[model samples]
Target: MKVESAIAQRISRDALISILLYVAPIALMFTTFYLTGYKPWQGSNELPFKAPGFLEDVFRNLSSWGLAAIVLGVGVIEFAVGLYENKWTKNERTLDIVCFVVPKLVVKPFVAYFGLQLMPYLLPAAKNIFEWVPFWWAFLIIAVADDLTQYWYHRIHHQLPWLWRFHRTHHSAPYMGMAMAGRQNIIYTIFFSQTYLTVALTYLGLGYAALFVKVVKSLITTGAHSSIPWDKPFYEIKWLNPIGWVLERLISTPATHYAHHADTADDGIGNYKGNFGNMFFVWDLIFGTGIITRKYPTSFGIKHYQEEEWYAQFLWPVFKSKKEGSELAANGPMVGDAVPETETVTLKQETANVAVA
Candidate 1:
């Protein structure tokens, strides 16, 4: 009972902090508009700047085939560089490929099409209403709102035992690379508030700003999942340490994000329980959900991973895992038991030689 009470209190505290985090930026946005005498609802034909026609065309293409091209390109590069460390087994490959392809080719388009049809009835008066806002301000507003909302979405999934299965697919991969970046359950993708949020913003005339934010956020998140450790130099180089300090806190970096995927937190470098930032690490810092160590975790994925089938991971509750004790199995527990601390430490020590190579 005391443990449950403590858990309840912690959740309440997190909820309060999340509400404040969500509101602060929006409040500041309005305040900035008021102080600067910039009002989108009041209506103006003027914008701060107009993007070039060719550039607009490029962004449009990026919204479709272009984005897929970029992801595929990066995945190929990661493979060529052996970033998966020979851990991409046949089952892993099937899961990763399906998760990557299905979302882009099937799920997203279905949502966008249905969402467009539904928005007219749901928000009849809101289409293109805020079109007058300047491009830069719109970009800033969308970036903050989208990322923060996603931070909460992600954090809650980890906190709530029932929702863990929905997110389990993302954490099942034993390796980190571009392949695992888009690897997620179909239901998780369908209910991804970020997609709907962006769509609603675009409907309200922030389409232009949404385009830029989507591109930038995608690159940042994908890079963070890569095994490249691009942010390492920032921590290593003496003069750049100052820049690293800001960069790690300001946005998600490979080092910070990898910790979130670490198989165990026993090493102090691994922190699967926190670091819920997506595009911006600032949200984690603000809500006290992040941890940063310059070192990468020696291992990753769930300590109790049962190698559930791809269909089970991607379509759970609809299709259950056949693996007897898997979390996705029928009548399985909401969350799996963690590997014992002693076992985890021993496993890490044994894997150390392979991890360093």
Candidate 2:
């Protein structure tokens, strides 16, 4: 009993330290900005928010091309490392490539353009409401708001049967890598709430902060979905375990996020029902939807997955799967009806019988 109590107390101390490590950078940044007289709450109507010239310059110089370059560089590394086997089917490859290019080239630009245009007309008087916010504060606000929205968006799609079809394409891949991160449906990309939120923040004069947060968020999410277990070493090295502990709680690490894409929950490492965090794992931890084992799943992808065409996965309702019983097919299960009770019971029975046999 004494040993158990000591172990628990030690874990509590380590957890607190880890959280501090994750939060210290944000605290420092906010303090620095405040010392520099960055006050978001005290600005005149004529020159609301009055962003620092350096910040404006940084935002202006930020290039989407640079992001593309990073993606390509990471892709080269993933390929060179042979992270994927013969798992990249023709449909999978096509879907991933198209999803990757189309969003940047078409969807995001269209959304941002229209969002900027619509915001002024819809809320004309509220134009610079949050403009007076300090850059650091604005960045923190946008980061949390954007990430929380995405967390719910992702969680709902998994919890509710109807929305799963749209998200299924992402989990269809048998392997994990940088390419897999972009594998999403057209509707999913278009309806993504964060894109509009970002545009709104830009209009509110946090464009620079929003841009910086977006870059950091992208890196965290991309790293989470990659096949490489980059965080593995931190967990393995005894001295770095504290860093790993805090990191997995603060953001989506490979171990926690990979569990979400794992093929089956039967394996201890695969947790298909939880770990839905995209950029921030804290949501999952707070919402009782996270599981962390510091281990990798042996298999990835959906259970009983039907091989649907790339078009069906990408276009969805417009291009239903030809596979008769597939969830994305025309005559298949309705939204919210993917897993029937009878089917679940039968599955359990089969498992029980196998165990007995």
Candidate 3:
């Protein structure tokens, strides 16, 4: 329950809260949903009212229990990753909980709800999106579209300072594993601000396309942030690599994302929050902000990684920093000034990990 050095520096807490916060609810939810056969109320206005009754049946799924199971499983993986990781100087076990819980609990669901409510208005386009594709296509479209939305919003976090202030909470974790992926500002829910892509697709009238994309976002983003690293081998297979490389470039991958958390641009400019993409790396490549590293960070977090307090970390945009030199107060999300010059600071030999090997 106690983090060794974290107690000394007071940078991270010894509280075992993340283990409980991240795990307990997921475990309970999974148990409750699976044993009780409970599913979330899975739809809203996204279905085209004019569709053949069969089409309605095609997309209308009972509320889902699968997400609870999946989220809990990932939560366990994150906990296990934290226990096994011996390298963290900041003792970020507790921080991991905050990172995972805040965004996943407060943000992702709200965004999903907004997207769902929008389904009604978008039902017309939602129907059209599927005119050419089959049911399975619905899955792919959902996955791609959801990630696509995340890709741009995530990218904005790094490019703009105000957004980065919220995002910095995610990056500030000194150690990362699968759980780290969820670490972020709750206000990130705001990024779900309706987009042209969603609107366009909604108008296209895709059945359950919106719903499917929501499911995929939770899974893919969770996987990319996980310590699993299964993608490396998958990427090695010539066929798989192309798919992964293509998707990774097209959507955010751990390779690109973890690099964004890296301390050095020479290694790669990670913490500046610039290399943002969720499900696709291609967004970065297309936008000219991509960095592909074969290696991961020995250390994580911004060089001068400073946040005022936990309250400040959570209610960020509203809670102005009482301290100085924070990335937020100096300007805001859009300002690029928070990024610091690194020559003055040097990484410990061990701190700088293998980059792009």
Top TM-score model: 1
Better of 2 and 3 by TM-score: 2
Best by lDDT: 1
lDDT of 3: 0.53
Off by over 4 Å in 1: 38-86, 340-357
Residue range 40-59, candidate 3, lDDT tens digits: 43433343335566534434
Q: In model 3, which runs have C-alpha deviations exceeding 4 angstroms?
A: 1-99, 106-133, 136-144, 193-207, 234-251, 268-274, 328-338, 341-357
RMSD in Å for candidate 1, one decimal? 5.6
Error of 3 at 282 (Å): 1.9
Model 2 CA lDDT for position 54: 58
For residues 1-357, write the lDDT of model 1, one tens digit per residue: 685587678778877876776677668778988898876666742335665776545335542343334334444554444335456878888898888767755666555555656777898998778887777767887888788778877887787678878898999899898778888888888888766765676667676677568779988998899878999999889999999999999999999999999998889998888999999998788777799888999898987888899899988889999998677888887653256455557888989978988
In model 1, residue pairs whose N, Cα or C atoms come closer than 3 Å (at least 3 residues apart or on different chains), thus clashing, are none
